[model samples]
Each structure stands twice: as C-alpha cells, then as structure tokens.
Target: MKTTFVSLALFLAVVAQMVASMAVITNPVSSTKGKGGKKLSVVWNDDGKSPKISDWGGVNVFLAVGSQNVQYKLQQLGSNLPVTQTKGSWKVDPSIGANSKSYFIRMEGTKLGSDGNPPMAFSARFELSNMSGQFNSTVQNAANGKEGAAPSSSTTGSSGSSSTSSASSSSTSSTGLSGAASSSKSSSASSSSSTTSGVAPIYLNSALVTVGAIAAGVAAFV
Candidate 1:
C-alpha cells in the first residue's frame, strides 16, 4: 500500500505540471475586407497561463490604393503605444477611392516583450484588383509553424481593379480589453481558424487539475 501511494503521488504531481504547461499557449485569428469597404477582426487568448501582458500581439495593417497608401495601427485596447493585448480590430478611414483599380493589403504582427512592448513577429501581404464588389481575407500567425491560407473572395475584378461602388461611413470604438470598427461593403465573407501546436485545450488542463486534486486527497486518506 505504501508503494502504491508513492506511485500515485508521483502521477498526480506529473499531471499537475502537465496541466500548468498546457495553459500558456494560444492561437491567433484575423479577418479583413477591402473592396466596397475596409474592416479587420483580431482574436487571441485572453485567459492563459503565460504572462497576461504577452497573451496577445499587436497588429499593423496597411492598404495601398493606386498611388495612395493608408496605414492602420491596432494596439491593445487601453494600453499605450506598442499595444500588444489579447484582442482588437480596425476599420479603414476616408475610404479607398472607388475608381481605384489595384490595391495592396499588408498585415504585420508583433509579439509583446517582458516590458509589454511589441516586437516584430510575422507579416503577410496581398494584392487585389478588379474586385467584384466586396472581399474577405483571413490569416493565421506564424506561431502555428504552418503558412496560413491566402485571402479569397467570391467576386472577381478585371485588369487587377475592382469596380465596387463607394463605401459608406466609418466608425471606431474600443472597450478596455477589445475593440472594433465599422465600414460598409457587400460580398461573401471568409474565415480561418488556427490552433497552437503541442498545446492542449483549457478544459483538458482543468480536468487534469481536478484529477490531481482528487489524487492528492486520496493520498492523504491512505
């Protein structure tokens, strides 16, 4: 019985360690539109073991239309410059020209440092033209070890130029933890989902913790 107790204690300890490790990593999600209007969506793990400051990364998005280039920088909701938080989004302002033929969209992700500053992580670029009306694009961060999928839309343009009508108004809003912007466009939407490799789900970690607690209680009784 003493030998069994020892083995059980060892198992519980191992399980506890595993559970703690599994709760640190997180996946990245993003979405963008650039035809009739411009919008962005970003999502990250808000509640993970890793330092809360480094949970989400900052983002910078650029839209180039004809000879004009517009830049939108998205940081943590309430954090100061170099914003790197769990989630945020952006919407382009002044709107891209309706007569624009070709355009480019660029996205860059920056990981947070120990001091809560942003450091370059990964980047992606897309060239679009002759857009039908609207388009949606999705990308995953490089943390997943696999190249993310490219942006795809339902409408097709001609001569690398989109003929969509002028976009509507633009509005921006942000809470303490998350943010979002609004724009107007019409087209099919697309989405992409990525998972951090070698990381288990949060529920699994909770289950392991519970099992470890039960094991420890039983060991006490023994």
Candidate 2:
C-alpha cells in the first residue's frame, strides 16, 4: 500500500510539472513608448523549472511583427535593451502619417529549445494592433461573427485587445452604413438569421498604429 501511494504521488507531480512547463503567456512588450509602435516583448519559461524570470538565463527569442518578413532577434530582457532603444516605432515607413491607411502592428513569437537552435515552435494569431497610436481596432466576437461586441482596455492592448471604444463606434457606423447601402434588403427572417450566425467571430488585424507624436508627424510626409 505504501509503495502504491508513493508511485501515485510521483505520477501526479510529473503531470503537474508538465502542465506548468507548457504554460505560455504572450503579452504586449511594455516600454516608455506612448503606444502606437510595432515593438513588443516576448517572455517565456523555456525550461520546465520556473525560476524567477531574472534567473531564466540567456535564451535567444525571435520576434516577428505580424505578417512582415522582418524578424528582430531579441537576446535580453527589457533592461538589456539599448538605453536609447527606438521605443514604439512601427515597421512601416515613418513617413506615413496617422491618416495614412497602412499603419498597423501584429504579434508573433518563437521559443528556443535545448538544442540551441532557432525557434522550435511558434505562436498563433494571438494579438493585433491598429497602430492608430490610439489602439482602436475592431475585434470580432469569438462566440459570433459579429464585430465590436467584446469589451477591451487600453492597457490590455498587449493582451489581445483592440482599442475597445473605437471598435464599438466603428462597429456601429459599419452596421449603419451597411444597412443604408442595402437596396435589395433580405426578408427579416433571413436578416435575423444572418445576424445571429455572425454574432462573435474572430477579430482580424487590418489597421495600423501610428508611432508617437514625433514619428506620426513624420509619417505625414512619407
């Protein structure tokens, strides 16, 4: 009986360890930049043992901004970053102003393995930023296909939230515009069904966040 109990305990411990090791958190890389930049941070526990992040040792982490081919290899934590690091600067041409339609940012990351090679695995469509320098992007409700129903926060932009207020206003305007433009309206039944079916859909990142006031001013010329 004693042997059996010890074995069970060990098994449980192993399972718990695995779960903890597999844990992952992809958050917005924080800095003094007043938002609106394509820069973000990626931190993870590459090892199964959870040590205070300061002791995580040197691990090569690769960050890919959205769909762009540009990959900035980050070797250290926030402190290790250059003192004059270009904070909150988007990958696009700095010449594009806040009004320019091409401003945007996306989230992507990879983890290094014990083999000391490039990323062995990668993250999925985690977060998207409008790069409006105001963080306002429409998020489709995950439960339905509808846009702009989820509540968000300015602080949560790094945690997979678009500018919530902006999203709401934009959603309302989009719905109104679509309704007005529909000359051959469908029957109420069909319309209701479609609306219901499109309730909460996965939001997409199509907008861009302009850099801080300085870069934004420059974007106007680019």
Task: Please give, for residues 93-155, the per-residue lDDT of candidate 2 as tens digits.
Answer: 111112222212222122222222111112222233332211122221221113212111111
Q: What is candidate 2's local distance difference test score?
A: 0.21
The worst-scoring run of ten residues by lDDT in candidate 2 lies at: 213-222
Badly placed stretches (over 4 Å) of model 2 are 1-20, 26-35, 38-56, 60-62, 65-127, 130-222
Give each model a TM-score: 0.23, 0.22
- Write candidate 1's Cα lDDT for 33-55 as tens digits: 23333444433322233323243
lDDT against the true structure, per candidate, is 0.23, 0.21
- Write down the RMSD of candidate 1 (Cα, Å): 20.4
